[model samples]
Target: MAGCDVKNNPTYLLVVAGAISDGAGRWLMHRRPLAKAHGGLWEFPGGKVEVFEKPTEALVRELYEELDIEIDPAAVEPVSFAQHDAVDDEPGIVILLYRVGEFAGTPRAVEGEGIGWFTVAEIDGLERPPLDVELAAKLGRLFPE
Candidate 1:
Protein backbone atom coordinates (compact mmCIF):
# COMPACT_ATOMS: atom_id res chain seq x y z
CA MET A 1 0.00 0.00 0.00
CA ALA A 2 3.03 2.23 0.23
CA GLY A 3 3.42 4.98 -2.41
CA CYS A 4 -0.22 4.54 -3.32
CA ASP A 5 -1.39 8.10 -3.70
CA VAL A 6 -4.92 8.35 -2.41
CA LYS A 7 -5.62 11.41 -4.50
CA ASN A 8 -4.78 9.59 -7.68
CA ASN A 9 -6.83 6.55 -6.72
CA PRO A 10 -10.02 7.78 -8.31
CA THR A 11 -13.06 7.40 -6.10
CA TYR A 12 -15.96 6.38 -8.23
CA LEU A 13 -19.43 7.60 -7.33
CA LEU A 14 -22.69 5.84 -8.06
CA VAL A 15 -25.52 8.13 -9.08
CA VAL A 16 -29.06 7.38 -10.20
CA ALA A 17 -31.02 9.48 -12.70
CA GLY A 18 -34.52 9.33 -14.07
CA ALA A 19 -35.81 9.91 -17.58
CA ILE A 20 -39.38 10.86 -16.84
CA SER A 21 -41.71 11.17 -19.80
CA ASP A 22 -45.09 12.87 -19.86
CA GLY A 23 -46.75 10.18 -22.00
CA ALA A 24 -45.57 12.19 -24.96
CA GLY A 25 -42.35 12.41 -26.89
CA ARG A 26 -40.91 14.85 -24.34
CA TRP A 27 -38.58 13.94 -21.49
CA LEU A 28 -38.05 15.80 -18.25
CA MET A 29 -34.81 17.49 -17.26
CA HIS A 30 -33.88 19.43 -14.17
CA ARG A 31 -31.77 22.57 -14.03
CA ARG A 32 -29.31 22.32 -11.17
CA PRO A 33 -29.23 25.17 -8.67
CA LEU A 34 -26.53 27.84 -8.95
CA ALA A 35 -24.79 26.77 -5.72
CA LYS A 36 -24.20 23.11 -6.57
CA ALA A 37 -21.82 21.26 -8.81
CA HIS A 38 -22.68 21.55 -12.51
CA GLY A 39 -24.85 24.44 -11.49
CA GLY A 40 -27.46 25.71 -13.93
CA LEU A 41 -26.90 22.74 -16.22
CA TRP A 42 -29.86 20.70 -17.33
CA GLU A 43 -29.65 17.01 -16.39
CA PHE A 44 -31.83 13.98 -15.99
CA PRO A 45 -33.33 14.28 -12.52
CA GLY A 46 -31.45 12.08 -10.03
CA GLY A 47 -29.03 11.92 -7.13
CA LYS A 48 -26.39 9.83 -5.40
CA VAL A 49 -27.22 6.28 -4.36
CA GLU A 50 -26.88 5.92 -0.62
CA VAL A 51 -25.21 3.00 1.11
CA PHE A 52 -27.07 -0.30 0.61
CA GLU A 53 -29.67 1.45 -1.55
CA LYS A 54 -30.41 0.02 -4.98
CA PRO A 55 -30.13 2.34 -7.97
CA THR A 56 -33.85 2.24 -8.68
CA GLU A 57 -34.68 2.97 -5.05
CA ALA A 58 -32.36 5.95 -5.13
CA LEU A 59 -34.02 7.26 -8.27
CA VAL A 60 -37.44 6.95 -6.73
CA ARG A 61 -36.32 8.89 -3.67
CA GLU A 62 -34.47 11.52 -5.66
CA LEU A 63 -37.42 12.23 -7.91
CA TYR A 64 -39.64 12.66 -4.92
CA GLU A 65 -37.19 14.94 -3.15
CA GLU A 66 -36.20 17.03 -6.12
CA LEU A 67 -39.44 17.19 -8.09
CA ASP A 68 -42.16 16.56 -5.51
CA ILE A 69 -43.34 13.61 -7.53
CA GLU A 70 -43.99 10.04 -6.48
CA ILE A 71 -42.98 7.22 -8.78
CA ASP A 72 -43.46 3.48 -8.56
CA PRO A 73 -40.24 1.57 -8.23
CA ALA A 74 -41.69 -1.43 -10.01
CA ALA A 75 -42.50 0.68 -13.04
CA VAL A 76 -38.97 1.98 -13.58
CA GLU A 77 -36.84 0.54 -16.35
CA PRO A 78 -33.23 1.00 -17.38
CA VAL A 79 -32.57 3.44 -20.18
CA SER A 80 -28.86 4.33 -20.22
CA PHE A 81 -25.79 5.24 -18.23
CA ALA A 82 -22.96 7.75 -18.47
CA GLN A 83 -19.63 8.09 -16.75
CA HIS A 84 -17.62 11.19 -15.91
CA ASP A 85 -13.93 10.94 -15.27
CA ALA A 86 -12.44 12.42 -12.16
CA VAL A 87 -11.08 15.92 -12.70
CA ASP A 88 -8.71 17.56 -10.24
CA ASP A 89 -10.22 17.05 -6.79
CA GLU A 90 -13.63 15.86 -7.89
CA PRO A 91 -14.42 12.18 -7.80
CA GLY A 92 -15.35 10.22 -10.92
CA ILE A 93 -19.08 9.61 -11.25
CA VAL A 94 -21.14 6.92 -12.98
CA ILE A 95 -24.78 7.80 -13.49
CA LEU A 96 -27.47 5.20 -14.16
CA LEU A 97 -30.50 6.68 -15.90
CA TYR A 98 -33.88 4.98 -15.61
CA ARG A 99 -37.12 5.66 -17.46
CA VAL A 100 -40.39 6.03 -15.59
CA GLY A 101 -43.56 6.35 -17.62
CA GLU A 102 -46.02 6.85 -14.78
CA PHE A 103 -45.94 8.84 -11.56
CA ALA A 104 -48.15 10.65 -9.07
CA GLY A 105 -48.22 14.44 -8.74
CA THR A 106 -47.08 17.09 -11.16
CA PRO A 107 -43.33 17.64 -11.32
CA ARG A 108 -42.01 20.97 -10.09
CA ALA A 109 -38.44 21.88 -9.34
CA VAL A 110 -38.23 21.56 -5.58
CA GLU A 111 -34.45 21.74 -5.31
CA GLY A 112 -33.10 22.73 -8.67
CA GLU A 113 -33.51 25.97 -10.63
CA GLY A 114 -36.27 24.61 -12.85
CA ILE A 115 -37.68 21.63 -14.74
CA GLY A 116 -38.86 21.23 -18.28
CA TRP A 117 -39.96 18.66 -20.86
CA PHE A 118 -38.05 18.50 -24.10
CA THR A 119 -37.70 16.26 -27.11
CA VAL A 120 -34.50 14.31 -27.56
CA ALA A 121 -33.51 16.65 -30.38
CA GLU A 122 -34.03 19.66 -28.16
CA ILE A 123 -32.18 18.03 -25.27
CA ASP A 124 -29.12 17.52 -27.42
CA GLY A 125 -28.93 21.30 -27.86
CA LEU A 126 -29.18 22.15 -24.18
CA GLU A 127 -26.20 22.79 -21.91
CA ARG A 128 -25.52 19.87 -19.64
CA PRO A 129 -22.88 18.27 -17.47
CA PRO A 130 -20.33 16.07 -19.19
CA LEU A 131 -22.02 12.85 -18.17
CA ASP A 132 -25.41 14.33 -19.01
CA VAL A 133 -24.14 15.16 -22.47
CA GLU A 134 -23.39 11.47 -22.94
CA LEU A 135 -26.76 10.50 -21.55
CA ALA A 136 -28.54 12.85 -23.95
CA ALA A 137 -26.72 11.34 -26.88
CA LYS A 138 -27.74 7.86 -25.78
CA LEU A 139 -31.32 9.05 -25.44
CA GLY A 140 -31.23 10.28 -29.03
CA ARG A 141 -30.15 6.81 -30.07
CA LEU A 142 -32.85 5.14 -28.01
CA PHE A 143 -35.66 7.34 -29.33
CA PRO A 144 -34.60 8.50 -32.72
CA GLU A 145 -36.65 10.80 -34.93
Candidate 2:
Protein backbone atom coordinates (compact mmCIF):
# COMPACT_ATOMS: atom_id res chain seq x y z
CA MET A 1 0.00 0.00 0.00
CA ALA A 2 2.97 2.32 -0.17
CA GLY A 3 1.89 3.76 -3.49
CA CYS A 4 -1.83 3.49 -3.01
CA ASP A 5 -4.19 6.41 -3.61
CA VAL A 6 -5.37 8.55 -0.73
CA LYS A 7 -8.87 7.19 -1.04
CA ASN A 8 -7.50 3.67 -0.66
CA ASN A 9 -9.33 2.65 -3.80
CA PRO A 10 -7.66 0.29 -6.23
CA THR A 11 -4.53 1.94 -7.57
CA TYR A 12 -1.54 0.76 -9.50
CA LEU A 13 1.38 -0.22 -7.28
CA LEU A 14 5.03 -0.11 -8.26
CA VAL A 15 7.07 -2.86 -6.63
CA VAL A 16 10.77 -3.60 -6.93
CA ALA A 17 12.44 -6.97 -6.55
CA GLY A 18 16.05 -8.07 -6.77
CA ALA A 19 17.65 -11.24 -7.97
CA ILE A 20 20.81 -11.30 -5.86
CA SER A 21 23.05 -13.77 -7.53
CA ASP A 22 26.22 -15.24 -6.12
CA GLY A 23 27.72 -15.44 -9.62
CA ALA A 24 27.94 -19.17 -9.15
CA GLY A 25 24.65 -20.15 -10.73
CA ARG A 26 22.74 -19.41 -7.53
CA TRP A 27 20.41 -16.65 -6.46
CA LEU A 28 19.17 -15.60 -3.04
CA MET A 29 15.48 -15.98 -2.21
CA HIS A 30 13.55 -15.39 0.96
CA ARG A 31 10.80 -17.49 2.47
CA ARG A 32 7.75 -15.56 3.60
CA PRO A 33 6.89 -15.66 7.26
CA LEU A 34 4.13 -18.15 8.01
CA ALA A 35 1.64 -15.46 9.05
CA LYS A 36 2.13 -13.29 6.00
CA ALA A 37 0.50 -13.48 2.60
CA HIS A 38 2.03 -16.23 0.49
CA GLY A 39 3.46 -17.62 3.67
CA GLY A 40 6.06 -20.35 3.31
CA LEU A 41 6.59 -19.50 -0.32
CA TRP A 42 9.93 -18.23 -1.56
CA GLU A 43 10.23 -14.94 -3.39
CA PHE A 44 12.82 -12.36 -4.36
CA PRO A 45 13.62 -9.76 -1.68
CA GLY A 46 11.96 -6.42 -2.28
CA GLY A 47 9.05 -4.16 -1.44
CA LYS A 48 6.82 -1.39 -2.78
CA VAL A 49 8.26 1.86 -4.15
CA GLU A 50 7.49 4.73 -1.82
CA VAL A 51 5.86 7.88 -3.20
CA PHE A 52 9.08 9.91 -3.33
CA GLU A 53 11.59 7.17 -3.99
CA LYS A 54 13.03 5.84 -7.21
CA PRO A 55 12.73 2.12 -7.84
CA THR A 56 16.43 1.58 -7.21
CA GLU A 57 16.29 3.60 -4.03
CA ALA A 58 13.31 1.61 -2.86
CA LEU A 59 15.14 -1.58 -3.64
CA VAL A 60 18.15 -0.42 -1.65
CA ARG A 61 16.05 0.40 1.39
CA GLU A 62 14.04 -2.77 1.09
CA LEU A 63 17.15 -4.91 0.81
CA TYR A 64 18.64 -3.37 3.90
CA GLU A 65 15.44 -3.79 5.85
CA GLU A 66 14.67 -7.28 4.68
CA LEU A 67 18.02 -8.83 3.91
CA ASP A 68 20.56 -6.86 5.96
CA ILE A 69 22.56 -5.88 2.91
CA GLU A 70 23.73 -2.69 1.25
CA ILE A 71 23.50 -2.34 -2.51
CA ASP A 72 24.82 0.36 -4.79
CA PRO A 73 22.05 1.63 -7.00
CA ALA A 74 24.54 1.78 -9.86
CA ALA A 75 25.32 -1.91 -9.51
CA VAL A 76 21.79 -3.07 -10.15
CA GLU A 77 20.80 -4.00 -13.68
CA PRO A 78 17.24 -4.24 -14.91
CA VAL A 79 16.53 -7.76 -16.03
CA SER A 80 12.79 -8.16 -16.37
CA PHE A 81 9.38 -7.05 -15.12
CA ALA A 82 6.01 -8.62 -14.46
CA GLN A 83 2.67 -6.92 -13.92
CA HIS A 84 -0.91 -7.72 -13.05
CA ASP A 85 -3.93 -5.56 -13.76
CA ALA A 86 -6.31 -4.28 -11.11
CA VAL A 87 -9.05 -6.73 -10.30
CA ASP A 88 -12.09 -6.15 -8.15
CA ASP A 89 -10.76 -4.42 -5.04
CA GLU A 90 -7.19 -5.62 -5.50
CA PRO A 91 -4.62 -3.09 -6.61
CA GLY A 92 -2.72 -3.70 -9.79
CA ILE A 93 1.00 -4.28 -9.29
CA VAL A 94 4.08 -4.10 -11.45
CA ILE A 95 7.26 -5.74 -10.18
CA LEU A 96 10.54 -4.56 -11.65
CA LEU A 97 13.14 -7.25 -11.22
CA TYR A 98 16.83 -6.42 -11.08
CA ARG A 99 19.97 -8.48 -11.22
CA VAL A 100 22.19 -7.59 -8.27
CA GLY A 101 25.53 -9.33 -8.47
CA GLU A 102 27.40 -7.04 -6.11
CA PHE A 103 26.50 -5.87 -2.63
CA ALA A 104 27.91 -5.43 0.85
CA GLY A 105 27.19 -7.75 3.80
CA THR A 106 25.75 -11.22 3.88
CA PRO A 107 22.02 -11.59 3.34
CA ARG A 108 20.07 -12.67 6.36
CA ALA A 109 16.37 -13.36 6.68
CA VAL A 110 15.72 -10.36 8.89
CA GLU A 111 11.98 -10.42 8.32
CA GLY A 112 11.01 -13.78 6.96
CA GLU A 113 11.00 -17.48 7.71
CA GLY A 114 14.44 -18.00 6.11
CA ILE A 115 16.72 -17.39 3.18
CA GLY A 116 18.42 -19.72 0.74
CA TRP A 117 20.39 -19.71 -2.47
CA PHE A 118 19.05 -21.66 -5.39
CA THR A 119 19.82 -22.19 -9.02
CA VAL A 120 17.15 -21.45 -11.58
CA ALA A 121 16.23 -25.11 -11.76
CA GLU A 122 16.04 -25.43 -8.01
CA ILE A 123 14.08 -22.23 -7.77
CA ASP A 124 11.61 -23.49 -10.34
CA GLY A 125 10.91 -26.46 -8.08
CA LEU A 126 10.30 -24.43 -4.96
CA GLU A 127 6.86 -23.11 -3.93
CA ARG A 128 6.51 -19.49 -5.00
CA PRO A 129 3.91 -16.79 -5.32
CA PRO A 130 2.25 -16.46 -8.72
CA LEU A 131 4.14 -13.35 -9.67
CA ASP A 132 7.38 -14.89 -8.43
CA VAL A 133 6.75 -17.85 -10.70
CA GLU A 134 6.56 -15.48 -13.64
CA LEU A 135 9.58 -13.52 -12.49
CA ALA A 136 11.62 -16.68 -12.12
CA ALA A 137 10.76 -17.68 -15.67
CA LYS A 138 11.93 -14.31 -16.92
CA LEU A 139 15.05 -14.66 -14.78
CA GLY A 140 15.83 -17.96 -16.40
CA ARG A 141 15.64 -16.32 -19.78
CA LEU A 142 18.45 -13.96 -18.74
CA PHE A 143 20.94 -16.80 -18.93
CA PRO A 144 20.14 -18.90 -21.99
CA GLU A 145 22.98 -21.31 -21.63
Q: Can you write out model 2's per-residue Cα lDDT over 1-145, one digit (the tens) per residue?
A: 5775755563678999999999899999999889988999999999999888999999999999999999999999999999989988788999999999999998999999999999999999999999999999999988642
lDDT of 1 by residue, 1-145 (tens): 7876755564778899998888778999999999998899999999999878998889989999999999999999999988877878788899998989999999999998999999999998899998889988898898775
Q: Over 4 Å off in model 1, which ranges?
A: 1-10
Write down the TM-score for model 1.
Answer: 0.90
Clashing pairs in 1: none
Estimated TM-score for each candidate: 0.90, 0.91
lDDT of each: 0.90, 0.92
For candidate 2, the 10 contiguous residues with the lowest summed lDDT are 1-10
- Which prediction has the highest TM-score against the true structure? 2
Candidate 2 off by > 4 Å? 1-10
Per-candidate clashes, comma-separated: 0, 0
* Best candidate (score: lDDT): 2
Candidate 1 residue 42 C-alpha distance from true site, Å? 0.6
